[model samples]
Target: MASSAIKHGELVALQELDSSSPLFKQGASLRVTGKLQEYCVGTAIATIVDGSVSLKIDTQHLRDLNFRVGSIYQFIGELLIQSDTDAVLQARVGRNVDGIDLNLYHQSMHLQRQFEVDYMRTRTT
Candidate 1:
């Protein structure tokens, strides 16, 4: 199938050998796991180029999920698997746990500060 013919959200198997029409086919949702690598924060693009699959991720989403480079994640996301060497991921479901405790602690502190600011603003107004 022509890569252009594939819909934006259409799912295709990452491996060229996969030909199962039912379990693996076009437009089917698939969960893939891969390590995060080759990313550009300025462009908001991250790539997971593996032996069987390749994925592209939005760094903003990664940041929201506290994903870090060199970390592994599971993505239940949309795919445009054009070929064995070409594919794209539009979303993901999981993130890296490296430094997660520290990250969460910082996040909690930030949230507490925001809550305090909001409370003060409301009281003043």
Candidate 2:
């Protein structure tokens, strides 16, 4: 059989990861949105924050992309968890999303999860 194709990134909130939530698999591809808190050019690392949750992102592979602090951005990457309180994203793609309503997005994500759970339960019944 042919090898399975790569999966699309899963949309997630920083809070879910920072809180050490068991909602996603380790090293899973993720799509997260947050405001750029800071960036270290020398280290090629950037910090993005949503609410009280913050995550460090490795930007070494994204040298072509310019990151501006305080700007809202969405990133698709692989999640790397070193510990309960430490996690990093190896960014593969990024883009600005300054116009997005983060609160609404978060609420929708919660609803989506509920729907998925219900659908799965129905299927297994």
Candidate 3:
């Protein structure tokens, strides 16, 4: 089985891991919690149920998604903080896990850090 990769500018649910936790470092397995609506670079605008938070991301490989407002999703992606807005996105990796796990994670050390071919749309071999 392969692990999924993450990106930027996507919404997610995060439950930060403790510093003592092994998954405290970058690229750790995180639990899905919620989803985000919009993200920029340095800061991201996200909502959780009836409330929301102004948080930061920890990755770069971003997969742009048009998130719906107040909707909760378990999407997994890289976390990024930009000058304008923060982002959670799908990143490229050696292992093959669909970037669209549509899941989320935690472990905010606060240190963090897509493309298409339709068929370039026709060969699944």
Q: What is the C-alpha lDDT of each candidate?
A: 0.54, 0.85, 0.36
How would you order the candidates by TM-score, starting with the best?
A: 2, 1, 3
On TM-score, the candidate that comes out on top is 2
The runs of at least 3 residues in candidate 2 whose Cα sits more than 4 Å from the true structure, single-residue gaps closed, are 1-4, 23-26
What clash count goes with each model? 1, 0, 38
Q: Return the clash pairs for model 2, or none.
A: none
lDDT of 1 by residue, 1-125 (tens): 64654323222323431544443444445654556777776876677634545567644544366556777655565555666544455564555544334334445656876998999999999
For model 2, residues 62-112, the per-residue Cα lDDT tens digits are 756778899998989888877766778888888888889999999999999
> Residue 105: error of model 3 in Å?
14
Encode model 3's per-residue lDDT on 28-116: one tens digit a residue: 43433443444455543333221344333332443454445444444344433233333333333212123333222233322221113
Using lDDT as the measure, name the better of candidate 2 and candidate 3.
2
* Candidate 1 vs candidate 2, TM-score winner: 2
lDDT of 2 at 26: 66
